[model samples]
Target: MTPTVSGSRLKSTVAALAADRFAGRRVGTPGGRAAGRWLAGQLRAIGASVTTDEFPVAGVRELYRTPEFAWSAGSTHRRGVHRRNFAEHLVSADLPAPRTGELAVADSDEWRAKWVLAPDLGVAARARFEGAAGLLVPRGTDAEGWMPKMIAGPPVGALPVIAVRTGLHDEMARAGSGTVTASMPLRTVEVIGSNVHGVLREPAAGSPGVLLTAHFDGVGDDPQQRLPAAADNASGVAVVLEAARLLAPLLPDHVGLAASLLDGEEAGARGAAHHAPNVRSGTYVLNVDGAAQLGDGAAVEAGGPAHDLLAALDQTGRETGVPLRAGAMPSDNRRYAAAGLPAIGIGMGMPGYQTPAETADRVETATLVAATRLVVATVLRLAVHSRGLIALPHKDELQREG
Candidate 1:
């Protein structure tokens, strides 16, 4: 008999991961370490053997303080709210204190010691205004008018670059003559990240194993606001934990089952990249990234040799009534796939992705339950099929998986 997934348990897990106590669970922070410990304890509580893998990561982004921003046009001063009106660009130079300067329009010749406002920021613009105080680059916002946060990107630029909402950016660019003050206490640091692994069962000799994964780290909360990160990954972690809890006893004898709660996924999936090389051969990987909403269908991206595994997922979705579709999921699964393992990445939907508005209350319990059920069912099929208890689907049977 199949074990049932508990929605209430999933909610509690998400709340614990997204709570203020963890401070957004950024990789390499005390909060992140505490979160990893908590997850290890959870796995142990379920009677699984838990172990952690540590890896060194360089150049992780850290924001020490809330940045201040404002602009003035003929005494009409306006202070832009962080996240709502503007955000720090990943390539921005460090500026702890606000720097004020006159605003220079796009066609202005006097670019020295001024804030250049342009429709877009480019290498040419940076070289042209190398002496300017900073740049006011216009960027688009999400439908909800929020500028998302990013930790990894290209090398820092020579001048501070701030992203303003298109409307605010255009306003500043057209104002032509104005005074602007901006600051960003952002810097890079080297840190160690951890990946928590829990073993539920080991496959019989010559049998393929299954690895379930979900990143437990967030971009971290801003100094001024609480970025709960409930949907971005806490939700996905909850689903994985719930599936592990229910799948522990029901997993077949020939099937090896384990769960990996990863860190540093927000820093360009460094943790997965570090852990992939150690995965046993002939292992099938399933990674869940977003489970807060199941709009349209769950997005699936298969990498490496996963045709048979993708067919099993497709067959599972049809039986379970959860829709699956083709979509891009650039997450940790790619790392395992690169290691010559069969890996599949799944994403549902996230509401305030990587923003201050990502609160736990917005997560849908129904979606959580659905995601857990799908994962559980798929694992049962794949693990059991490895022992010839069930026949694997033909390659032509797989479709709608990217």
Candidate 2:
């Protein structure tokens, strides 16, 4: 009989990881480090041989305080809420000090030293406002008034960019000559991130093993509020932990089980990039992300020489009555795939991704249980096949045969 994963345990684990003390689990912050320590402790408690891989990451943005934005039209003034009303761009430049300027439309020359408010600004418009005080764009929001949190991307223009709610933008538009003042103080820091590794069983020489992985880091919270990235990642980590606990006693000697709780996934997948090259060549890797809100079934994306592994996963899903389908998940599994390893990425669902509304309460316990069951079942199926596993031909061997 397969060991059961307790729903209460899964819920508690998610609660612990998504608690306020973790401060959204951002890579370089004190809260992030605390979360890592907590995870390491949990892995050790599971009686698995645990270790950590430490690495240095640079150019990580740390939000120090609540960014402020206010617009004044003559004698009337209004302030924008941090997350609900507006949010700072991920790559926004640090304001040396508070700056105030009149709100002007994009096409007007008055945007020289003023806050340029527009529905959308194209590349040419961005170049035109290279000397402007700042740029403000109106963005759509969900029913709860939550806007999409920005992620770090390519280099932006010199002027800082901020996104405000469409209502706020309309208000600013009505105040044709309103003065807008904004402040977003930030600091770039070099920080050490760690990947927690726990081994359930050691593989024999020349024996291929299975790896379970999930990223635990999230977008750090703003000064005034917590992001509580429960669905984005904590849900997945909870499932992995439960699976490890249940599989420890049943893993076959020739087939090893290893789990990695990675960091800096939100910061351009730095943790995955650092780990992929070091993975043993023939190891099978499965990365679970966003497993909280399951919609019909789990989404699985496979790459490289993973025919046998994918087939086993599909079979296990069918036998266990869990739905599985092909989908695109551009996550840590890609790192392993790039290194010629058989890799699969799994995604269940994420309701409020990278936003403040992603609370622990939103996580579905039923989804968590199903995801954990699927992983456990898949691992057991792989173990049974490992005894007679035939290695796929190498590229060189296939080319010679052709």
Candidate 3:
């Protein structure tokens, strides 16, 4: 007999996964890697096929070596001009260094100028001036005090661009020689990444395959700190895992119940974008991300024929006394929807979103379990409904469409 996912088990899983040490599971960090590994282990325990796909991100640097700058102050050289601490700065390449009379922005630049003064553009400007591989941004100030704001300039060519702390910029300002030397170490390579999958493939009367997806990666504001992404995503991944465990045995032999723990959803939705072109026709999908809070319900975001799927899910929630809300795509559901495939997104409730409390203790276990059951039953029922007219395309038919 297949193991049934129980509330007790899910609770334990949630508690263990949400432990303090995980540090919010932010993407591109050690914590995020730990979260991904944990997710892989969970899916493995449930017999899922797993594979990690690696890709490269351009113009990114890791805090490996700090660049030093110094200048001559009269006869005495006042050493140490600029410095900062950050894992990496996203910058553009091909910018020049500052020389006497080089254009520079002060605290009085217009907000629009500041807004457009993005690091990418700064790299471009620096490159235009110095013809360097990248730009060294000593954090500068705007109209306000030390705050995060974009720096504007032309597009920096292939060179990498990065932003350092304002303290560093002040040091550069003191370079009496009217020249500044900035240095930065860059990280460019292929890193290990992954995509988790669970499938219940079988033959059913005429049922089309159904797919469910959620990205396990979390984005973080701080490059160094661990982001305990409890609400942003850990919750969504949990829902998908629980659903797979519960529905595995009940799926019809001729039908397919597939779940994916996609990677790189934070880095430009690369994972979802990869899955789009490969979407199978006649396949239905439910994409869940973000945590759900207690007292609140899961939002439904599918329209068109897919709306029927949402309605069916909502109806099942009602029958089971689960409070599920309706809404639009907020996750990977956009992938399938954009592909013209039937798809929807389901999310949890939270007070301050993207924070730990956002995925608070309000996820109704009973409702979640009931929701899974309903999804399984509804998929089967819909498959049976579509079997009659949802023609199975022959090789010729597929070739013609292709």
Residue 391 deviation, candidate 3, in Å?
24
Cα lDDT tens digits for candidate 2, 32-150:
88998999889989887888888887777766777888888988888888778887765567775778987888667655777888666563355354667877888878777787564
Model 1, C-alpha of 72: deviation from truth (Å): 0.5
Q: What is the lDDT of candidate 3?
A: 0.52
* Residue range with the least summed lDDT across 10 consecutive positions in model 3: 393-402
Compare the candidates by lDDT and give the number of the best one: 1
- Kindly report which residue pairs in candidate 2 clash with one another: none
Query: Model 1: what TM-score?
Result: 0.95
Q: Candidate 1, which ten residues in sequence have the lowest lDDT sum? A: 393-402
TM-score of each: 0.95, 0.90, 0.60
Q: Which of 1 and 3 is the better model by lDDT?
A: 1
Rank all candidate structures by their TM-score, best first, as comma-separated numbers: 1, 2, 3
Off by over 4 Å in 2: 74-77, 119-130, 388-402
Model 3 TM-score, all chains together = 0.60
